[model samples]
Target: MALIQTSLIWVAYAVAVVLLLIIATVFVFIYQTPRDRAVSVTTVCIFTMSALLATVLLMPVDIALVSSTSNSAEGRKKDWATPNEIDSIIKTLKIVYYTLYSLDALLCLLVVPFTYFYYEEYDEEATEVGDQTLGTRLWGAFKYTIAFIILVVAIFLIGFFVPYAKQAKNDGRLDLDYFQRLLLQNRGERALSFALGLLMTLGTIIYVLYTGAGLALLPVALIKSAPTVSAPTLAANTASQLEENRERQRQLDGRNEGRENGLESRDRRELEALIREERTLIRRERLAAESSGEDRHWLIKAWIKVEAVFRPLKLIGGLLLLLLALFVFVSMFITAVDKAKNSICGAHCGYILGYLNIFQPINYIFVKSSKVFPIDYILFLLLVLFLFSASVVGIATVGIRFLWITVFKIRKGHTSPQALLMATVMLTLITLAINYSVAMLVAPQYATFGHQTFCDRAPRHPGEQPDCTHNHKAIRPCTEMSKNAVAKDVCTPSVLSTFINGVTIDFPFFGLIMFWAQFAFLGVYLVVFVATLFKTPKMDEDQLDADLEEDEEEGLLASTGKRFGATWQDITGHARTPNYGAAETNGERA
Candidate 1:
């Protein structure tokens, strides 16, 4: 029986993991698509709505489980004498069941219908492209609405009426045990039936309201606007606008080319004069320089000084950014660990710890004992240390490179190859550290619970165990059982441990991959920066003058045209902007 139970549980867990992975991959693919902004926004809105519905339904279940375990009777039968635990549990169950029914009704009757309408509106313009007539689309929508309403009503009936009727079957005679009767007569049963009925009636009313609203609004909109322009009129208008734009563009291009030609002519003349002057100076200095044996040493000294100052500053800035990135990564890692610990270690250490182990496969190995390692904090510290070490190495490399370039007056661009090598080394170190950290954090959490021995022994059967040893003495098993039996007996643990372990296993590796990917981007940027620095420099004055002239020409062209053009005035016979009509002239004498 235990083997069967464990196998089934494992199968369910595997199925869930596969489903989640598929869902995540699908979403990632959708997000990567180059869809238009409106389509992407609509997709995100729908996804968010679905996620919210799922979260709302699942959160209640989680709460019920936690509440039930926390308030369970000491012995299984102890809760039989006091009805409150059973009553509270039944109440919670009913609330959860009804909430699910309400959500189903909402999705089918409200969200689905609303989504259909929204899609219809969005696709209205595209209907003609696919040769789909408006009447056909409307008919399809009507059929969908009817089907959706039927499904919602069916779900409501099945979810509420089945449970209610089953309770009625068990309770009508009042011959069963106290617990059975209590379950049959609970308030939750009544609530579910009532809510289900209300939802069905409400959904019908809403459908009627939607039809009436659509009828009233459609004609008003149609009356306020004439039938849209025919195809021929649209085509003619588009062609005419295209022609007008072409003409305007031709005129603008002509003016630009003429201005460019004039600038070129002036530049050519200036260049010729500068060349002649350079030749004249060369001729005058050639004889004297040849005789004196003088050299231009100052220029080389100045270039070396400029390179010295700039190199250190660049290295320092790069190191600072790298360190900041590492710090952020470490902080996020620590926060994840702390959250996992708090979630796993609730108020009752022994019970909660056992519950957590159910989800973590590693707990199976250690389930026989109570002794557990403080692995969560240790994993967190190791991650921090790895990130800190990487940061230190990065800072040190930057400092060493700075010293080599500035103090040593190394040849221009000579330190770049060394810098690249250091970056590669840092990248490798960080990658390995991150991998090790992730492995340490994730692998141990999944290990079997083989380390703890005390937990292995069975408590003497309930009646033989000491009263003081049990926390909930009122519970049947604890009050009546021998210590040996109670210790040996095992109950199913909570699945929360699996969830936390799964997160630890997946997130760190994924984070490390992302970190390395980001480093690749930084490396590419650095390579580009180095290339730019080593490339030939251009004369600044000529580039500045050309930029200024381009700006001036753009400004002139922009100011030359009215936004709406002359045709707009001719058609409207008035300007769009406010105008104080010349003070209405009246014959002053009159």
Candidate 2:
């Protein structure tokens, strides 16, 4: 039966993998297209559907494994049998589910980078049609490579530490049976479960909160400012300009009609001619005025003024996001400090020691409070804000620069594409540094708190002294606890290892690394776009003439070459022109 079940599990895994691959291939094909409104909508729909299906399929396996072995008997004997089997299965399922979910998250994050890349490449290809420059493309490739390296390192460290922290929580639960024994003698398992549960639950909550907050900020930052001119406004302006021109033409025609009526026969003829000339002059004036007005309306200078007015709004939005992210960071730090204190002193030590110990008062506050606030939540929120702020700053900087370039026609001195590529690299590096610093600062808190719990478990080991327990007679020394209890207990080495592994994989550190890498790519693209805006190639008059002449010469050569290559009858038949000499002779004979 076990073998059959295992085989079934593998079959399910295979199906899921195949489905995911198919979905990913579809996305890849769509991603290769240039950005368009329809494509964006379609991409979002595809991603959401794929993720939903993957989640639905994944949840069943997790539920089945967890539910099947949840009530199994515990002991060394059981450890070698059903209990260990169940635990192993549950752990495997959890890891698999988390990994797939992370992949889902990654795919969603990838949309931005893919769009940016497509747009940038299209722009480059379109602009550099005649003179291909390899510098920008090469530099972009180099920047992506660097970003990928940073991402890998960050993910590795996150994956390494998270499991260790979870293991500490599981290990601390080893004294559960001992607590149950004490309970039969009128004691309780409250202390042991509380100690273990606090670390695991709190650590998870913190990580989730921080990650959620960070992700939430991305969309807010991306909200485009309301368009400066709506379609209706443009239409109204066009109608008004047309009306003004028509009124001027009508007045000119009335004046010409009056002059035409007051003349003698010869004078009247000349007057009619004068009226015709005057009407033409009026038409020319009307056309000149209309063209001038249209030019003024569409000038780059006008758009710059509009952008300038919107600048403050963007700055305000960006600053708010930054502040929110900063708040999350500070909150995470505080939570970490509290958790560390709790783990070191044990669950209720803060309450007992707080009045007596001035240095450790904070721990008491954390314990007596019914809810331990999650620092990670704050960190996640801050991350969201940070991303939002960074995006805003990036857009604003590029937008302003572009506006100036367009309005003022600023000259870019060099034709080197390398300059734009370098700017992109710099921007990407800056984004990575910022994200890394944030993660590093937040990760240590989770690690420190988790570690503190592991240390507290040391004293609870089977061989330790029994001074800590309330009932001396009822409690055996740590040394007296059976090997079976140590092996099969929740706090056993195996359980601890499993728990640590779980926590490490659950946190948002990996996601953050992926996000920052993509952000770096975006930054590079933005730099390229801004550089392109400022640099307009000088129009080569001589080159333009030479190109035109070359085209004419090619046409002439192609005609001659085709005629020469043709058979004589075919060439002569098509070469016959109008027989003008024959027509002239016929007319003379007639």
Candidate 3:
């Protein structure tokens, strides 16, 4: 029965993987809007979905492996995958997991960086089309590949192996094999643990802030979605925008240097994009100003008037959402800190197999309150709702500053292929880091499935799993088996635990580096959030005006890419041409 089940799971997994890839490709190539936004967001969403699909598909088999041998647990033994059929199932899933993981990693690492540089427009007449040979294009990809490889190597050397290698000999790690030595080293893990804690702390901060924004806006967004309830909008100063567009065109022409003047390249692509966005904003504002609601029927006109009188409800609802977002975020963070401060875990523990833990206090409260008010249900509901909302906001949030730093984020509403690829690279790192952070945030619920705690499991025989659980209680920590040595009463790893451990897969160092880089983003999000508080956002300039479709995050690293464009233009003194060519009075840009 289990063998057939496993085969069915594999079949389903295959079908799902193909379907997901096709869907992602369709979204990217056919249906994407605001092209750069699609590139950045879809990359993360598709990869995350694929990871989740694998974990979910394997879960039933994992549960079956730990099923009780007898119907009743009075004298029954845990299956623990002891049967040959179960073992075969485990093997099948392992192969399936790694196969998908390898493909995902290949796409993220080798293919993404190569495309980032290789895929660019070339002018047919820039150099008589002679310089635009296959060799030149391949050279571009090769340089990017080599540079990316060098960066990865340097990160490992500096962040993990180099410092640890120096101390390895001093700690008599010479006695261990290379793999054992690296894995067994305590000093580096201490560094990594602290790094992980700091990262969770900062990620929580950004997460809560955006969630708050989403929740706050959600009320207004609901209101705006109505047929006649939209608040009046102010038109932009487009006369100035026209002047700005003219200046941009003049500057774009300056960068049309040499024979590339009218030929395709970065300059022309950018100028057209930038101008296109300016024109769009100008056109939108002009249309808004011209189209008054005077033509509406008497009933609709009356409805709008009545809705305006109730505008304060949106404000009240917005505040409640802000509070809810903060409450959820704080609960999740506290859970992590509580795990870090556990009697077994304490200051210097990574918890066996590097499990990120849960919100103990909140759980206890929910359990106690569950009997009275179904608080547990409410908690779960809030978590799902707010996290879903946060994910929506997060995709559009200007949190990935690598894109803002390395590539200038001109507010073009479209990206050149190179910019799109760069966004993908930045988003790949984000998907990994944010996934881990989110796993940690929700670990308590997911990791404790069908068990009390992740650490309260069967004891390891000496060097099996780390006693980062501290060998507390001396006796095995489970409920099913109280007698026989043969009794396999231990908890099987949870779906979350399996994914967390397997997510990083072969490269442990990559996890550490990705984490710390995310930590640095703490400051970026903090400044951005703080600025939002200090200055009223255009999105919220009027009454009840938030929308999910818009990227409302702002400040120096605004999601709209306003500040980035301003800063670049100021620094370069309005460069000759744009980032890509499209022949827009190209000679004057620079």
TM-score top scorer: 3
Q: Give the runs in model 2 whose Cα sits over 4 Å from its true position.
A: 1-319, 325-382, 385-389, 392-437, 447-590
Tens-digit per-residue lDDT, 1-590, candidate 1: 32343344335434433543444333223222122223433343334333322322232233223222322223222222234644454355445445554554454354546444544444645675876675665666666677667775565455344333332234333222321222333343434433334343332232122211221222222222121222123233334433443454454445557474543554444444544433433433332221121232333233333332343243344355344433433432333343345433221111111113223322222222212222322333333333433332332222323323522111112222222223222222333323222322222322211121112233357543234335443332111012333322312112222222222222222223332333333343344334433532121112223332332332311121222232233222232332223653111101
Between prediction 2 and prediction 3, the one with superior TM-score is: 3
TM-score of 2: 0.28
lDDT score at residue 133, model 1, on the 0-100 scale: 70
- Residue 519 of model 1 has an lDDT of 32
Candidate 2, run of 10 with poorest lDDT: 348-357
Per-residue lDDT over 1-590 for candidate 2, one digit per residue giving the tens place of the 0 to 100 score:
56565566467646664665465334323222222323443454345434534543443333233322321111112222365676677567646644544443333234334333433443455456844345654455445555545653454444344332232234443344432232221011222222222323332232232233323333233232322322223234334434444554455456567574644465445445545444433443343232223323232223333433443355355456545544544443443344334332223111101111122222222222202223322333344334433432332233213323521111112111222222222222233233323322333222112111111122354753222233324322111122333322322222222222222223323322332333333334344434433532112112223322332332311121222212222212222221235344211311
Q: What RMSD does each model have against the real structure?
A: 27.6, 22.8, 15.7
Cα-based lDDT at residue 11, candidate 2: 72
Tens-digit lDDT track of model 3 for 1-590: 44454455446446655754554343233212232333434564456444433433343333333332221222222244345644564455556544554444455556666655555433457449576776777786687689767754453344344343332234331232221223343444334333333333334444444443443344334333222212222232334445656777777676565553483667667777767656555654543332222343343334334444444354455567556545544655565555445423121112212233443445445434333322343454354445444433443333324433523231112234454454444433333344455444433333322222223334358423223234444433222122323223233333333444322222334344433343344444445445555554433232122221122331211222123333333223332232334564423331
For model 1, the stretches where C-alpha displacement exceeds 4 angstroms are 1-93, 108-110, 121-143, 155-590
User: Could you give the candidate ranking by TM-score, starting with the highest?
Assistant: 3, 2, 1
Ranked by lDDT, top first = 3, 2, 1
Q: Where in model 3 is the C-alpha error above 4 Å?
A: 4-80, 83-93, 96-104, 124-131, 152-282, 285-330, 351-392, 395-413, 448-489, 494-590
